[model samples]
Each structure stands twice: as structure tokens, then as C-alpha cells.
Target: NVAVILAGGVGSRAGFSRPKQLVKLGGLPVVAHTIKRFQSHPLIDEICIVSTADHLEEIERLASSLKAHKVKKVLGGGTERRDSSLAAIAAYEHEALSGPLYLIFHDAVRPLVSDEVIDRVINALRHYNAVDVAIPCADTVVSIDQVTNEIISIPDRRSLRLGQTPQAFLHDTISTAYAAALRDPPRAHTDDCGVVLHYLPSEKICVVEGDTYNHKLTYPTDLLILEKFLQSNGGRRKVADTGDRQLTQLRGKSIAIFGGTSGIGEKMAELGERFGAKVSIGSRRNGVDISHAPSVQEFLKEVVATHGKLDAVVNSAAVLTYQPLEALSDEDIVSSVGTNYLGALHVARAAYPYLRESRGHLLFFASSSYTFGRAHYSVYTSSKAAIVNLTQALADEWDGADVKVNCVNPDRTATPMRTRAFGHEPQDQLLDAQTVALDALSVLVGETTGCIFDVERR
Candidate 1:
């Protein structure tokens, strides 16, 4: 798959002396940030930048810095937006990319576009020949006549949607559609979806739900909002801990600690407090059962109600049951899965609203058992594996919400549960609770979400 980033816009709407795409955003060019999203995406194999001849060298300089993908070509765009699309298609053909290649066209101004959005568009290409990204209109859309500036026929507001990029398609299909559309006078459309719809009316362009946070940089005020977003996330990215405990990244932040009553969880709460976080606990001992959705919901609600702000939620609640699969009772199985897997869901579902409001972090704990399927603990390991997948899935689902999701997989920890399960692993061979707690907090502060961070083994 390849991404074609269009930077040919004249920046007429933006009063800046230079082009809007070239404008510095969070210490990088707006286009650089836009390029980074695709460059870092695992699926993207190559990139093509389309711009005016004057800006090609500068964009090449910036693209060189991001060695994430092979920049196959940097070509000059046509006078119109459609012209750039043509140039990209021609270059793609010149490269002789294999039959039915996938192409994603994104605007350089929309720097915050997430990998989830790009992935969804590419996934949709499997079934749909052409696809577009759009979000439901929050405000009622009105139709007005431009001639007299009078109210015209009002379409159903419920059906209206605001479109965004990157609009994607099968390289051959969209290029064919564009080839047919270019025969007539240039059509005034903002996106390729219109080009396909107008020329290839028979083909249906699938619409994927896009994120609100993926706002394009058009107006001057948008620069201020993006700048603030950068600062909040800690300078162009999240605050990743570099084993520097003295930094105290969580200072003044409020965090909810599920399963915070004993062992590792208790130590985590204590460390959070020590690191300057206002920590709240959710555990069975505190009248909050993670397996029960309602209890988890109310626990977080109360935490936010008391603290007045919630920055993160760490769900370290899991039962380490050491029993063969056949030997485990039905009730025991249900309890383990519910607490280990569904418990994470309960916290995520319950905390989404508040987390999204604050753009907070959601951290779930997985055990070392997840990687090496320990025979006696089949159910426990399986549930922990599910937690890892859930963390990634939820991260993608909530990309627009900006609520980061991650899983921390720790080795055998010196906790009551470890002693209860395996009697006694030597103290030297067991990871101390404090070490695991700090590593988990590192995940919370880091900008890299949707990861399975493994704590160092003793």
C-alpha cells in the first residue's frame, strides 16, 4: 500500500506568507506531521508526495528525515487538485506497481489523522473499490441558494456527513475513474470521492467513520489548537519515560487505580501518589468488583467526582488461578475470564466518556503467562492474551477519542498472588512490586499507545 500526500495547495485561506502545509506545527512542518502518520503506519510500503515544483525540494528534505518508508517518488502536482491526483497516478504507473495496488490520498494540512483511520480506509479497500472518510455532522446542515442567499430545500440533517481524508481506493479503479472525469471541464470538488461518484456513478464508495480530532489545518486559529494539543501530549508526542524517575511526569494528574488494594496494585497507588498523582483505588476490598460492570462504572464516576479531573485508569485486576482446564469448575472459569478480560472492558467502557473528555490513558495489565502458555494456568494465560488484544482493539476504536490504550506484561512479581500460586520463587528471581508498578506508569506517560510493554525479567 502507498500513501499520496498532496501539498500543492496555494494556502489562500491561510494568511501565512508561506504555504499552510509548510507551516511549522509542534516544531515540525504541518506536512511533516502529516507524512509521519503514514510513514509510521505498518501497512504503508511506500509514499508519494505531490506538490508544486517550488516546494518539492523542501518536502524532500523533510521526508528524508522520516526514513520510515521508501519515498519512491516526489512529483510536481497539476494546477488543480485533480491535477495532483493525475500526477500521482501517472507516477504510480511509472513505478509499475503490481496490479490492483491500494492508494491513500491525504491532505498535508490534516496532521493529526491517526493510524486507525488510515487502517480502516485500507481495510475497506478489500471489499469496496473506492472509500472515503467522513464524520456525522454535529450541527444541522442547511441548504441555501447562492444566487439570492435564500433558504433552499433542506435535506435530512441525519443523513448529512462532513467528509475528511485520507480518501482511499484501488489504484487502478480510481485512476480509471479520474481518467474518465478529466475528459470534461475541471469539476470543482474538494475530494476524490466526488470524482469517482460523478464519473463512475455505478460504483459505490464506502464511507468509513473518521475521527473529529483529525481536523485539517485551514484557519489561523486551528494552529493555536494544534499547538496546545502538542504541549499537552508533551512536545510533539506523549511523555515517554526514559527511566528518569526524577522527572515526575504525572505531577498533579489524577489517576484511577483498579485492583489497588493489595500487592502490586497497592504499590502502584503508593508510587502514583509519590510521583505527585492524585490516585483513587477500585478493588473488591473497596466495594468495587471489576467483574461487575456497574461497580467499575460507579467507582470511576466517584473518582472523577472527588478529584475533579481524571487523567488515567490502570486496571491491574486479575486472578492467578493455578488449575488444569478440565479440573476448573464452571464458576471458577467464569470468574477468571470475567475479572481478567471483561474487567478491562468494564473499566474501558465505563471510563471512556471521562477519559475522552480528558484525552487520558487506559492501561491494563497482562501476566508473563500470556507469552508462555503455562499448562496449569490455561484460563489465566488465555484471558491475559485477550487483554493484550483488547488493549490494541480499543486503542484503534478510540483513536478519534484520543484515549490511549496499552497493556503492561510483567514477569513473576513478588506479590501475594504469586506466593499463593507457585509457593515461592526465589526473591532474587521475582520482580519486586515496585519495579512493575513503575514500568506500568512508564506506559502511562509514553506517547506510544497500543503496545504490549514487557517489564524486565529478574
Candidate 2:
């Protein structure tokens, strides 16, 4: 398994005098975190980094300083992103790398990539010749006529997906495609995926799930968010993604799902039981109003009393308002905020004692909508954003007690609530609630804390 991390961009748009990849993000160059993610990955054997000519020395020095044994070399990149990727591919040929090699290319700007994202790309190479990573687009995208400044077409939001990296490909296949692409000087594709699609159209590219936190550093605002998140996260050892082992770990353990009557919450309850868990559902069906603190406290107390002990508390409940902010009634605004943000907090605070006693976990739900902060969904997006920050804060606060707090920012999922909001979308297009529930089960048994995962794709 070979990984090539692209860090050669000028990043003039970022308003940084230096290259954005070299810019300090939490006291380390942005590319360092990206390299370390692969270095720490169990499957990755060797790393080859590509950066600008001027920065290659510093990059090499940084890698050496970090005592990275896996880094094969730090080579100078070309004028374009594709050129850099081609450079790496050329080097692989020069080195006489053996046949049936799996190659991965990732943007250094997206420094917060998780092991699961890396694992998915690597794992897919077993069956797929080419693999791409992407999250479902949250916004309705439009294709406009550039010259006329008119809307040319409105594509189905369900079909649109926002692309991300590390894009994995069979080395021999991509090498041939890239060699053919280099023959055409007039053509330039934006990403490696585009390169594959254009030159290797006959090959099918499998799209795996991508993390929302696997964001590229483009603007100053992006840098601020990335820096703050990294600083807050500090450092922790990562847990291996042990598939069905999570089920065995949860067996016979008690868990309370605050919104476990419908949608993701209800499904988690069923999965928990199927995995041999003692599951308790806390929702309106059980007369528990999560928005109210006292009600949450009393209900959790009852849950613990009934179930013996609580191992994990997951809050999957949320409410949203899509109308104009000013037009929204004060009641609707408060209800949205209270239900989405405070409701999770109410559960977290109330369940902390039981979780602390068992050294268990706290899981919360966020939406990809939090990323865009789109208009008309101010209260909804703002509250979800607050939940993300709150997830980290609670993790920090509970660090001493060994309780892990994490958030899964799922893209559009097929649920009763989403159906009411986004009418008539094919159910098959949306993410299944059970998939997210299974992810939540792993988080419960995992070692990491203060992590935010994207549950966007299959």
C-alpha cells in the first residue's frame, strides 16, 4: 500500500504569504497531520510526499525531525496538482514498484482525515479497480450557463455528492490513464477522480463514505475552524475499526437512547437488542421530553434504575425550521434550539453520572447542514453547530472520568423527519438509520474521545 499526499498548492486564496500546506495549524505544518494519519494507519506501508520545490527541503527536515521511518522520500512537485500526482506516479515507475500495487492520493489541506476514511479507500481496492471518497451534498446544486448567467439545469439533490480524498486506485490502471492524460496538454482535470473518469471511463469507480471533518483548508475561516478544532482535540490514541467486535463489546451492556422511539434513535434500540444489549428507549413514546432538563434527569434516573446501569447514552433527536428567520415565531425558534441543542445537553448532563460510573460513552447527532450554515436555516444550523462544539467541550470536561463524547454529523438520512422536510426523494438514495446505529455502537466501545465522525455515505 503506497500513499501520495499532495501539498504543492500556492494557496493564494487563503491570504497566507506562505504555502497553506506549510502554514502552522496548532503549532505544526498542515501537511504533518495528514502524513501522520497515514503513518499511524495499520495498513499503510510507505509514504511519498509531494510539495513545492522551495518547500521540499523543509518538508524533508520536518519528516526527519518527526522520526518518520515510513516516509520513502519528500520530492518536489510540479506546476499543477495533477502534475504533482503524475510526478509521484512517475517515481513509482522509476522505483520499479511491484505489480498489483494499491495507490492512494490525498490533499494535504484536508488534515483531519480519519483512519476509517483511509481504511475504506484501501479496503475497497480488493474488489474495485478505482475508488473515490465523497459525502452526499447537502445543498441543491445548479448548473448555470456561464455566458448567459442563466440556470441551465437543476440536478436532483439526491444524486449530487460532494467529493473528498484519499482517492484510491490500482497503481497499474491509474499509471496508464495518467500517462495517456499527460499526452494531451490542452486537458487539465481538477482532481484525481476526474483524471480516472476521463481517461478510464470503462472502469467503474466505487464511492465510499467521507468524513465531514476531512475538510480542505481554503479560506482564513477554514483555517480558524481547523486550528480551533485541533487545539481543542489535543492528542489521543486512536482505536482500530473492529467491525463486528463492537457488537460483542456491547452485548449484555445497558444503553439509553434519548430519542429512541423513531428515526436513528429507534433503529439503534433494535440493533442494540440484536447485538445482545439491554436497550432502553427514552422518547416522547415513553413520555420523556428531552428539551426539558428536569424531565431528562428524571427519565434517565428511571432508565438506570430499570436497566441496572447505563453504558452509553446516544441523543439522535433533532428539530429544524426552514422558513425565514424573522418570519419564524419566537416559539418555533426556541423549540428548534431547545430540541436540537439543549435536548442533547440535557441528556449528556443527566447521563454523565451513570456513564462515568461505567466509564462509558456519550454520542450526539449533528447534520452536514452545519457545514454550510445555509440561509433560512439559521436556528437549525446554529444549534447543530453548537452541538458539535458541545461534543468537544463535554469530552474535555469528562476527560478525567474516561467518558468519551463524540458526534456523528450524518448527511441526509431516510427518516420520517427528513421525509417531511425533503418531500418525495427516493428512500434508497438516502442513508439508512441502521448504518448510523452500527457506527454509534463502535463509538461506544472505541478508545478515542472528542472525535466528530461523518456518517454521510454507504
Candidate 3:
């Protein structure tokens, strides 16, 4: 299967001086995110990008930085979107006669395309020649008169669907459709599916389910919405369980754990040692204050100096205060934000050089309250949310350098921090610290980044 990323548009609608595809969303360019989806997919055999002439060299550099090995061609596209699609199709024209080929057309701006959508399209191609992805329309559809600006006809909402990308077609099917389309091209036709439907009337174009998060980046506000989506896992649904699996990857690796004096951090450090990792623990008890940049930087510098390298750094250091906004003390607000939010920032900044050198992993901890604000723990909840955002931004920023960044959003856990805030909870009702620690270790060794692992008791 070949993935064709159409990035020819100037994106004047997005109000950017440059094309929106080159705009940085999380940390990388928007097109980089789209390319990564297909590049990492096991089923995708090759990737071809149709970029404008002015940005061709820049896109090539971006692909090279990402190590996009599957990118076979970065051809120059024409003025229209259809012309870009034709360029991708024409690239494989000679090769199509040798064997079967599947072409998946997708917009470079729609970076949130999920694996499920791609799978559905590929599966449908086995039974049908053409396939498209779309979601059921939630809004009412009305045909409006252009000149009078009045409603002409109302279409049933159930019959309406908003089209999305990763539209797939067999090599011969789309080629034949475009060949006929060139004789008298439709003026306003934008999608490949429409061309197939109009030219090849007998060919059936199947519709597959598309995710709501798989939206194209058009307006400026869409950038903020997509960033939030990426922070919230970007349409990933599976929750991982370590289940007593052996972490062989941790053996002989160097790990630095902050807030390792007690609680989840302590448990993680113990497990790291048990698994043969060269563990370096730090906390206020050991003259390491995460809230202080110099203190955190000095600790990491010593860890690297002692261990000879740093493979991973985990920042579980956090302060939680339960108090109403009106009754909270100035000291309470400062401590919570400083330790939880700014501390994560400091750790990321200090650890980047080492992690980038080793292509290492950086992990942070967030609470379940990060998704929403709680009454008494407003500052604490907001700080956790900030941590989630920081993890995603850093993941994008360091993707080219091969540094992985992720966060663990554990539910109410039986930790010393929780006991201090709300004492004496039932053991069964709370997640064990060891369980959460195991999950964190799995993330450190796993290949996923810019994700939130939710640890909930079964």
C-alpha cells in the first residue's frame, strides 16, 4: 500500500504567511505528524508526498529529520488538489502493470488520522475498488439559494455525512476514473471519491467510519483543538497493563527517579534496581529540590557523570494541597504550582541534552484530576493539566531528536501524598503504587510518545 500526502495548498484560509502544513502544531510541522502516522504503520509499504515547488526542499528536510525511511518520492504538485492526486497516481503508472497496488490519499493537515481508520480503508479495498472515510453529520443540512441567501431545500440529517481522508483506491480503478475526468474535468470537484463516482458509475465506493478527532487543520482555532486532542492521547483507546511482564529492556540502563524518597517514585526505583537498572534516586531528603532549577540540574549532571549515561528520567515529584480558592494561603498556591508544573518544565529542560544524546525516554506523572477541575484542589488539578500539555509539546519538539516523552495519569493511588491529603482510604478502592510503577516502567521501554496512560483498578 502507498500513502499519498497532499500538501500543495497555500492555506490562505488559515491566515498564515506560509503554508499551514509547515506550521508547528505540537512541536513538529503539521505535515510531519501526518507522515509519521503512515510511516509507523506496519501495513503501509511506501509513502509519496505531493508538495508545492516552493516548499519541496523544506518538506524533504523535515522528512529526513524524522527518519522517514518509507518516503520514496517527494514530487512537485500542480496548482489544484486534483493535480496533486494525479501526480501521485502517475508516479506509479509504470509500476502498476507489474502487480497490485493500493493508493491511500490523505490531507497533510489532518494529523490526527487514527490506525483504525487506515485499517478500515485497507480492509475495504479487498472487497471494493474505492473506499472513503466519513462521519455522520450532527448538524442539519440545508440547500441555500446563493443569490437570495435563503433556504431552498432541507435534506434529512440522517442521510448527511461529513467526508474525511485516507480515501483508498485500487491502482486501475482511480487511474481509469481520472483518465475519463481529464476529458471534461468537473470545476468544483475536490475529492477523489467524487471523481470515481462520476466517471466510473458502476464502481462502488465504500464508506468507512472515521474518528471525530481526525479533522483537517484549516482555521487558526483548529490548532488549539488539535493540541488538546494530542495531549488527550490523539484518539488512542487502549489502556495498557504490565501484568508481571519482565522488563528486560531496563537491564543495564541508567535511570534517574526524582521524589524517590517515598511513594510511587520509591516503588519505581526499587523495581528498577530489581530489574538490574543502574538507578539514581533524588529528593529533598537527598539535597535535591525539584522546584529549584539548579538543584534539579545538578542532580542530573551528577547522575550522568556517575552512570556514564542517562537512559531515562522520571519526574514523579509533586505537591498537592486541598483548599478552597478563597481560603488558600499564598504559600500553598506557590508550592503546588512550583513543584508540580514548573518542576516538570525544569526537569525537561535539564534532561533534554542527555536524553537527546542517548535517544532516551522522559516520563512525568499526572493525576486523574487533570481532565477536570476539582473543588478543593483547583491549583493541583490545573498543574496536572499543565503537566499533560507540557509532555505533549516536548514529545513533538524532541521527535526529530529521537527523544520520547510521555505521561502517566493514574487514578487515586495508595500513595503517601494521597494519604496526607485525604487519609485512610480503603485499600481495594485505591490503585496500588506498585501497579502504577510497573505501568510507568512499561512506558519507559515502550515505543509510544505524546500519550497519557490511564491506570485504573479493574
Against the hidden reference, what TM-scores do the models get? 0.56, 0.56, 0.78
Alpha-carbon lDDT, every model: 0.82, 0.82, 0.90
lDDT of candidate 1 over 74-159, digit per residue (tens): 98996789889888888877444556687789998888787678889988988998999999988876689899889887788788
Tens digit of lDDT per residue, candidate 3, span 276-351?
Answer: 9999998999999888999999999999999999999999999988778888889888888889988898899999
Model 2, residue pairs in steric clash? none
TM-score of 2: 0.56
> Whole-model lDDT for model 3 versus the true structure?
0.90
- The numbered model that scores best in lDDT is 3
The C-alpha RMSD of each candidate to the native structure, in angstroms, is 18.8, 9.7, 4.3
Enumerate residue pairs that collide in model 3: none
Tell me which residue pairs clash in candidate 1.
none
Residue 31 in model 1: shift from native, Å? 0.6
lDDT of 1 at 343: 87
